[model samples]
Target chain A: MATETAAATGGQASPIALEEAGICVDSHGGAIGLPQLCPDWMGNQIFWLAVTLVIIFFVLSRIALPRIAAVLAERQGTITNDIAAAEDLKVKASEAEAAYDKALADARSDAQAIVAQTKADIKADLDAAMAKADAEIAAKTAEGEKAIAEIRAGALDAVKEVAKDTAREIVAAMGGQADAKTVNAAVTSQMKG
Target chain B: MATDVNGAAEQSGGLVFHPMDQFIIKPLFGDGGVGIFTVTNITLWMAITVLATIALLVLGSSSRSTIPTRMQSIAELAYGFIRKMVEDVAGRDALPYFPYIMTIFMFVVMANFVGLLPGAFTSTSHIGVTAVLALLVFFSVTIIGFVKHGAGFLSLFWISAAPLPLRPILALIEVISYFVRPVSHSIRLAGNMMAGHAVMKVFAAFAPMIIISTGIGLVVTPLSILAIAAIYALEVLVAFIQAYVFTILTCVYLKDALHPAH
Candidate 1:
């Protein structure tokens, strides 16, 4: 590489002179042609390349590759394990959700039962209180009617007594007083008619 | 030796581009001819890549946390990406070869990204390197197919599903294609890396056009710089895509080897 620059700065070597040297490059460092085709360099590159390949082969096969393979396999295993764990966690979460739903449903049913019981109890108490109040109202209405009937009978009987006494007093005052029985009979007949 | 001879000469008082010069392998310690085992820029960059791979793969995952940190995530992403590709393209039976396929992917991808750094040498761009990588997959897959299935592996090239009349022709094509896999696989990666780098260098050469001619430079300089930036961004994408293509192609071939059914 430096030879090319040197040739650019310095003078060109005579073709024959550089050719007689039996080398690829002229003394001025410029290549006679494409250096890749140069037989002089092929041997060196091929030889070193063989050594380099062998060294690389050994380094990779014996050490690097196996190490890398282990790391990769380990990573793969770890990923698989993590996914499995996630799946397990997911299953557990669903189970917990199911349990929660079951408990909620159970509580809802229990609340409905309690509400029904309370409603039924209140209805039974109201029905009994209504029945008791209706019975009391009927009893009071029958007693009040019986007491009015008694008062009327007593007043009618008293009116008959007073009519007989007034008849006897009027007869005596007129100087032709009828008997009490007769007056009572006559007033009863008149009241009857 | 490169025969293009595209040398830089300021005496011409014009643009002298040496785009291929960056691919040249030079000794790290001193100026000398590169021997087979010479420690050149290739070695330096390859070492750097290997270190980066290790650091990312080994130390990054040292924690082995169930929860990955950033570096650990990157390492794991790479591992899982290739592992899935191999499994999907090949069969479950191909898992035994996971480490081998993983090594190639890590090497190619790391070298590509590392090369993208300014002044870095791209190891995957060289045919020598890519060819070797491809051939290893080719040869190993071939051997595995033969060892596992014996003569039955030849059926990979023999298409019984085709009508008997055209079977031979189709078989011939299949045989040719099967043989050409390594060539195509290797060249695809190298060519992509090389071509992108060369285009970037070509554009970069014009970046100093203003110094040469203010009149033409005003138009050329900014355009060239923009082109380089755009190509650089594309190269970054290509670097990863090429690596993916190579590794997946390897898996596809491995599938043929393992199954060889059709």
Candidate 2:
């Protein structure tokens, strides 16, 4: 505040002094042409300008820029990696589905083959049992025929013997002997006839 | 009415309000003559711009989170904005100078925005700063053009596609425009900033006058305030646009440097 007052007073006291000194105090009590017309300020402004701009350039190029670039690159890399991983999973899922399909097909064919083989085995067993049963039935019928023929022959012989005994009794009642041989001869002749 | 008071003060040799007083460069410490070593308001504001840039670009984004915070997003937005400007206007080959272009963009934009603060100095509003920046662009582009294309860089001035009779005349015009680039570039930014700030100051001067006046104060005060508000909004847009224009022009000049064909 003191310096401001002093500068203001100095401007009032000797405006010519300030103007001759190249201090930019105009008639309006304001500075003009310091940034454009003044030579001394140029050198200082240029010097500081160079210094500040160089520092800013270095800061941006070396530190801030590279960091941002790295972040962008990292994000891109992650996105690509995720896409590749998803593609790999998709391929694996399709492969699993194919394997399941193949296994199901194989199981169906395997079951069909087993059923066919079992059916063949059962048919062979049934045919063999039927042949054995037919042979046993034929043998029993032959044996029954032989037994009936033997009984009929025995009945014929007993009937011939009775007939001969009856003839002999009749002959004894009638007071005539020697009839057994005759009776036997007569029965045998009748049976032959 | 403030102009009348200022005029009366000037005639009376009393206190005169100089709106341009804000643009003065005085030594921060003493009333001594400013030398090359004297730290002036320009230096202070420039240093502030640098610090603010560091805070935004370095410290704000130090984490580099994939999900950015607001400050980090701002840094990234600025980075991408300048990068695209360099690439789109200057082409892919100009990407090597992206950092330089980005520095200038950030510095100008931050200086302009910070200057909008009530009592802050606007360093970029001075020709000393803008001229240096523009000359740097001009010199670097010229050097790159000479180094890359040798004598062929002169072809930028020669319009080969023009009619044979008017070619020399066209070339003269082109050369004059080419040399005028730095002058116009520096003046454009400084002029816009200086003009906008001066206008706001003028409006502010009116505000006090009209508010204190007996009869017209009621009506004129609100009008001045509204004008200030409206121009303030416009200045905000102008600040961003001027920075953008400076950067894009730099890129365009760089493109010429890299490819000097007509």
Candidate 3:
């Protein structure tokens, strides 16, 4: 009802004023009268579209790219640092290996010297024992020879006593008168022989 | 009866409701709230927008040389302008969204310009059109936020930098803000287009009056012509500005969606 009144008012007033002013205005094909498929829809589309576009702009520009770049840069830095560290470690390892080899060589030489010294000591001890055994055998042989010479001398002395005794007994049986001269001569001859 | 009708009409507010008219074009609907459906009118405009953007972009990009042509320079200027805007608003993280931003700016700028054509339909004039576009953005951004942060996206509305005691109040504000997105998004474009057209109509309605007088008619008619010319130029500037404003807002929204800081 209100719309009808407003429309009637507009219709009456606009035409009357135009006629009074000796002018006829045709508003049929005016910009406002164009048949739109959906004004509300069009308006909404435009509004929401603008919003969406802005959102997309904000997200891509501010958040995602910077983080990605930062992560990439950090990764690159870490990788480079790791490579450098590995190189340094390699050099250090090589130096350590060299030092280890030198120490091993020195230890090996030291061990060889100790072994040679021990072998020499053992050889000397063996030679000394052999020399001592030879000395003992020589001393025993000399003592045995000395004992044999003494025994021969005693046997000879006994033999001589027995011969004299036998000669005396034979003389005494033969003649009393020639006993003393015979005994003396026999004794003298025995001394000269 | 006519007098009574007028009296009653005057008592009530002057509200015109046309039930026979299709308020918002429903290009797509289904029996159940399911499946893909197409919106014909919007789809047509969308295609038009895309083609117009491609035309401009292709033409602009075709002239590639050490010494750039005017068209190329203009394109470059637009690119640089949006790029700077994104950088300033979203920071350095906005590079990947560059394509989308550029596309939005180009599409909107073209749509606005097309409205200025002699007999072209102003697509942004309707609320339904604006609503769809707004809803698209709203849903897209919300989905993006969820995809990126999963369940944590809800925290954006619930949490803020405010103190514990003030958190509830802040949460309420956040919720209001979230709901208001579609309204603001739709209103901005509709408001600009409506205001511009209304003013133009007011000025144009005066054209016949100025031409009716004999001696004054000559002076007034040209003056009206000049006014129209001036208004038209202003409208052009407005068109470009509206497009830029729309695209910028979209960028801002997208930034929040991606980040979603309390």
Enumerate the candidates' DockQ scores in order. Answer: 0.42, 0.23, 0.03
| First chain TM-score for all predictions | 0.76, 0.53, 0.54
lDDT of 3 by residue, A1-193 (tens): 1122334443445534433432222122111122233232344355435544454445434543343334445656878999999999999999999999999999999999999999999999999999999999899888888888888888877766665666777776775444655665676678669
lDDT of 2 at B219: 76
The Cα error of candidate 1 at residue A40, in Å, is 1.5
Give residue A8's lDDT in candidate 3 (0 to 100). 40
Docking class of 1: acceptable
lDDT of 2 by residue, A18-123 (tens): 5456556444446543334555566667777787789889999998888777766777788899999999999999999999999999999999999998998898
Candidate 2's displacement at residue A82, Å, is 2.3
Candidate 1 Cα outliers beyond 4 Å, as residue runs: A1-22, A161-181, B1-8, B11-13
> Which candidate number maximizes DockQ?
1
lDDT per residue for candidate 3 within B1-262, as digits (tens), equals 3233434544563222221122223344431211123343444555566556544445554534434567655655676787788887766776666666665676567767876665454566555556666776688778888988898887887776777898888889888999898889878886677666556555564565543455776676677667878878988998998888887887787777777875
The positional error of residue A101 in candidate 2, measured at the CA in angstroms, is 7.0
- What DockQ results for candidate 1? 0.42
Per-prediction CA RMSD (Å):
3.8, 7.4, 22.1
Q: Give the winner by DockQ: 1 or 2.
A: 1
